[model samples]
Target chain A: IDAVCTAHGLSVAEFHALRARATEAKTRAYCPYSNFRVGAALLARAGEGEGESGGRYVLGANVENASYPVTTCAERVALGTAVVEGLHSGNGRGFRAIAVSTDAEGPASPCGMCRQFIREFCELSMPILMFDKNDTFIVMTLGELLPLSFGPDNMGVKDPAKP
Target chain B: IDAVCTAHGLSVAEFHALRARATEAKTRAYCPYSNFRVGAALLARAGEGEGESGGRYVLGANVENASYPVTTCAERVALGTAVVEGLHSGNGRGFRAIAVSTDAEGPASPCGMCRQFIREFCELSMPILMFDKNDTFIVMTLGELLPLSFGPDNMGVKDPAKP
Candidate 1:
């Protein structure tokens, strides 16, 4: 736990708080069809505040379509929400961390598209924490999921260069 | 135009042609990473020793994954190719009759969880087609897309007859 906090430059208390939010969000998952509910929460850098919460974007499970093909995963829904919110905020800062929770037997991992979309939007070093029902977790970097990925560079789209 | 056939009741020529060769599948969609690409061929069905060709099964594209969360759009890719082949097969299965496509514009119209999966395995119906580049499509059936939709009554799990 300490190592995870240190790697992400997050204080111990702050990391715990993010995990709590993720757990709460998990209950909101709309998975009546698959019965595989998932939840995600995104934490942004401190200092940007408009509402009671500052620099934090929380996303709950939202299943949009009945046709399986049209269904969006919890992680993507959350990420999309965060991206839209972040863009509107105009801070130009990427997410600092993301926490995920699932009810699978072991740790439930995100699908391939979720990781790609997350990697595309965040920095290589962004911290991602995946927790199982038992509260045990596997913490890693977004880059670990997608090594040598095709990103903005391939598309020739300029990302706001990292400061 | 002579290879494919479809039928609401009469077995449209174009869709029927592709339904014969359901074996020896097409491209393997190795989507261990999120680079969704797939290619499929809707074969024309033929009678045993009769040399009758009018059945088809569409092939799929390759959808990749950088990580587990993001995966390829196999359903759309296969569906698209099927639609293209259906039109050219010209056995008389119209394009607009198809409901799903396996392409890249949006999420592939199929997922592992839906009833379409059951339709794919059962071989209950004929003239299966998928969509092409445009929102249009090829011919196909519920059995082609879904092998066994969760049948609540099959396992004696739910007795709708009594309730």
Candidate 2:
């Protein structure tokens, strides 16, 4: 755990917070159809002038609609909320890490759609932590999860928020 | 236009409103990435005890992110907003019709993902209206857009909002 934190520039405390908060966020899920609750926690990257440890956290739970495709996943909900709050990618205001929690017996990673969504704001090296019901976790980088992913740059779209 | 309205059970005024509102909603799009704005309007189905004319309209525009996959389509945005406003499927609170507007030269259909999402709350027979920049339009039923779809019932999940 210590080695993992050092490699990702996250302190032991932050890692613990990600797990606790993600688990807590699961209870707020609005999934009555699948009953598969999912929660996500995003740690912001410290902005300029702020110290390395100054990042904050944002949390979200899955919001499901009767129309299955209308559902917003936990990761997306968190990212969307963060974007609305002005913590967008580029301009040195991006995300550092993301943690997800689910009740499955094994650690569950973000879905294909979510992986693509995360690629929009996070760097390829960003760490993704997935926790199972028993709190067991596995970590992977965003680039590994969604290899050869398409993004804004692929379409020649500049980050509108970047100076 | 009158023939289209008669076939769809929409009043002429409603049809005009759909075109105007969808076009207006396109201006509210947050799509900095695509720079391709899209908007949607949904007309609700009158609930039980309410007359056929009691249905209301909801509007949404595409919300994009630095991550292309994280962007919410205009159709899903409108549906999600409607679901949060207490309009859902299987409880007599379903939708009557949907209209989409894009600045493309020709009328554009909803993407495959949006089609799947619409299938969740709308009846297969529900009409989807697509309008191009010139106001020329085409209409197709949800079933025609997404044939042989998978839904809550296919997974044995009853509508939680159903009485």
Candidate 3:
């Protein structure tokens, strides 16, 4: 765990906090339709001049609609809220890491759509932590999860919000 | 137009309002990635005591993320907002009609994901109106857009929010 923390530039305490917060966020899920609850926690990259421990956490739980496709996943809900709050690629403020929690026996990663969503604002090397019901976890980078992903540059259109 | 209004049980004024609202909503789109703006309007079903003309309109515009797949389509946005506002199947207040507007030469329909999303809260016979750049239009039923779709009942889990 120490080696993993060092490699990802995350302290052991931060890692534990992410897992705990993600698990707690799961209780807030509004998934009456699927009975599948998911929670996500994001570690925002600290602004310049802020020390290594400056990163703040943002959390979200899945909000499902009767229309299955309208269901916003936990990761997306977190990202969307963050974006609305001025933490997004367009604003040049991006996330450092993300953690997701689910009740499955094994660690469950974000879905295909969520992987695509994360691709937009996170660096390729950003760590993604997946926690299972027993608190066991698996970690991977955003690039590895969604290889050959599409992003802002692929469109060849300048972000209107950017200079 | 009169033929369509009669066939769909919508008054001519309602149809016109949908077109105007959807077109106006397109101006609020935040799509910097694809540069393909889209807007949507929903006509909600009135309550039991409310008259046919009591239906209210809801609007939404596409919001794109740097990651292409994270982008929420206009139709899904309208539906999500409607659900959040308590106009959903679980509350017995579903929508009666939906309209979409885009700048394409011909009318543009909702994407596959949005189609699936719509299937969840709308009846099979619900009408979906599509408007082109010139305001020329085409209309189809939700059933025609997404045939043999999977929905809340497919999982055989009774909606916990429903009786």
Candidate 4:
């Protein structure tokens, strides 16, 4: 807990709040296919964790479909909302950090696609906190989840060039 | 157009129907945030594209949220559904191909993250068809997009243990 808190430049209480929010969000997920409930929360630069009103947003459990190829994981749902909101707000800075939790026996890791997208905004060292129902938690950096991953930059996309 | 038909083992007319369905699914897209609606259709097996109902399924657009940290791209939405349906049907085989279309200007490609997940279910040579307005199109295999990717084989995970 202390390590996760320090890594995000957050207080222990703030980090706990983030995890709690993720747990709550998991309940609202629409995952009828996998029955794998996941929840996530993001701390925007100007988000609630920063003591701001609208900067931080929370997203909860979403589902994947039987179409196999059509499923969306919980982590990407949270990140995409942040990106869309950031674009709409006219300040394209995406989420500064994210937290995810699942009801699985062990911590559910973010999918590979999400790991790549997370790198698009947060640096490799950006903190991603994950927790399981057992109260077991692991905090990792996006870079660690995907070593040498590709992002928008690799496609010649820069922040200023994004739509 | 010809390449897409050939890749999916479909006739030109059949591929057009899938693309049309993909185009129509865009209408139901929940991209209230981005307003850049997208949709997808999958040709499940070799015989499906030819209208034999060869296990093909259709999926549409769903967006992600910043607070959620998991975004369900239209393509992923369609493909994930295919995965579950395959298992439930006891086919045990994954989707053979997927096609995606979006309202964004020019041809928009799947993000790196989606590519990784797509590779998880299909072989390296699995075809992904992308199309844009004006009949502009591009074709590529999973290998072309992900190049060298990591999958269950890399993690010592056997097919029986895969979800």
Candidate 5:
């Protein structure tokens, strides 16, 4: 936990809160198809005086459709909610970190589609925290997870919140 | 148009409206990445006393992410919105038909992921209407679009709305 806190600049409290909130969000998932519930929480970059845990956080749970392909993973749902709320366009940098919790025995990482989605709003160095049911976890930077990634910069598209 | 109307049990006006609405929704897309715009409209089944066009219609425009795979196709976006609106849990059938419009030369088909997503909420015979830039179109049933598809049934799962 100390290593994670140090590596990501998150206080121990912030890390614990992220885990609790992400686990809570997992319960709200609509996944009759997969019976696999995944929850995600994002820590948005905060303003000047806000302390480590003071940043705005948004939660998202997997919303599955009967058609499996239609399933919106926990990661994309969180990011989509962020975009709709105008968080992506905010100052102080876009996203600081994202954490995901799932009921799987082993840590489950973001899928290809979600990795792409993260590439949109997060810097390559942004950390993604994955937690399994047992609280065992693994962490990977966005850059390490998706090498040679394509981003909005590729198309000369700046921030999504900008016109 | 006449054949589509006759074959699909839709009146001429319904067909025209689906095409027009889908085309209009295309204008709302946020695709700075691919510059590939797609719009989709679903004709939900109305309750007994509803008018021909009275069934609620849901519109979706492709919302892109910097990561290409994270980019949701227009079809899934519309369907996801429907799920969030409590429309999927309605007494009437979830959706009767889906129409997609794009600026591509020939009609654009829904992607493989979208085809899988469509399989969940629609019946095998559900028709998918594809419209190109010139207002030209082609119609195919969901079963035809995705052959031997996998769905909730495959996983012993059921209604997306049901807990």
Candidate 6:
């Protein structure tokens, strides 16, 4: 935990908080259809003028619709809420790490859509922490999860993730 | 508005509000990638003990991700929020109508994924209202949008829409 946190610029508190809260968020999921529950917690990067030590956290659980495609995954709900709440991405300000918790035996990764969504506001180097129900976990950077990602730069639009 | 509202059991006020709100919701969309903005509103089934005439309205706009597939349609966002806020789908108590507004020349219907999500909560007869940028519109039932639907009943689960 110490080495991982240090390497990712996350504090021990942030790491633990993400895991615990993501687990807790799963209980709030309204998944009567697939009966699958997922929870996500996002750690924001520190704002300008502040050292890159402390940041805020946002949480979301999978919100499924009977229409499977309409379901918003845990990572997305967190990202949407963050965007609406004014967590801008650009100029080195954006999310630091994302922690996701699920009830599977193996660590559950973000789906394709979520990988795309995260690409909008997170850096290629942002760490994604996936935790299985047993607390066993694996981590990957955003670049590895979604290779050759398309973004604002692709469309010639100025975007935070580009820089 | 009056004719369609009467046919769908929606009052003129309700129908107009749905259109206006859905259109308004489109402005709040975070679609820097696709440059396409969409909005949706859902009318809840009336409360138990009350006739199936009036229910509350929930709104959501398309929240886009840099990844196109992860881009959530406006329809799903509304449904997810409804579920989180304690709306139940059964016993004539799910959504009665869904309205979508987009800035296209023709009416923009909910995507296939959204159709499936609606299936989880809506009755077959539920009407879907589509509005173009000019508010010129079309309407279809959930059944028509997605025929031969699959539901919780397929998995041997007792669900309201299934019965």
DockQ for every model comes to 0.09, 0.17, 0.19, 0.12, 0.26, 0.30
Q: What docking class should model 6 receive?
A: acceptable
Against the true structure, candidate 3 reaches a TM-score of: 0.60
Best by TM-score: 6
Displacement of residue B72 (Cα, Å) in model 4 is 16
Task: Report the C-alpha displacement of residue B93, candidate 6, in angstroms.
Answer: 5.9
Per-residue lDDT of model 3, residues B44-138, tens digit only: 87766667665788787777876655688788767655554456654346788999999999999999888877776678888999999999999
lDDT by residue for model 2 over B18-127, one digit each (tens)?
A: 88888887876767667898988899877778886768887877778655556888887677556544566534777878999999999999998888777766778788
Error at B135, model 3, angstroms: 1.4
- Those runs of model 5 whose alpha carbons end farther than 4 Å from true positions after fitting are A1-29, A37-61, A65-70, A74-150, A154-156, A161-163, B47-54, B159-163
Local accuracy of candidate 1 as per-residue lDDT tens digits, B18-129: 2221211223656433334333443433323423343444555445433333333444555556545543223333222223334355424445542343332223454345
List the pairs of residues colliding in candidate 2: A67-B120, A120-B67
Look at candidate 2 and tell me the lDDT of residue B28: 67
Q: Taking the tens digit of each residue's C-alpha lDDT, what string does model 1 give over A38-103? A: 888777664445443456656756464443345677777887886676542245456778888888
Tell me which of candidates 1 and 2 scores higher on lDDT. 2
lDDT of each structure?
0.56, 0.79, 0.79, 0.66, 0.78, 0.79
Candidate 4, B9-76: lDDT as tens digits? 66776677777878887777876555667788876653323445555556767675764445577877
Tell me how far the alpha carbon of residue A143 in candidate 3 is from the true structure, in angstroms, after superposition.
Answer: 14
Q: Please identify model 6 stretches exceeding 4 Å from their true place.
A: A11-13, A28-35, A43-59, A63-72, A80-93, A147-150, A155-157, B44-57, B64-67, B84-93, B160-163
Interface RMSD of each: 7.4, 4.5, 4.4, 6.5, 3.5, 2.8
Instruction: State candidate 3's DockQ.
Output: 0.19
The candidate that wins on lDDT is 2
For model 6, how does the per-residue alpha-carbon lDDT over A60-119 read when each residue is reduced to its tens digit? 888765445556788877776566444655345678899999999999999887888888
On the 0 to 100 scale, the lDDT of residue A115 in model 4 is 69
How do the predictions measure up, each by TM-score? 0.58, 0.60, 0.60, 0.51, 0.64, 0.75
Candidates 1 and 3 compared: the better one by TM-score is 3
* Candidate 5 local Cα displacement, residue B104, angstroms: 1.5
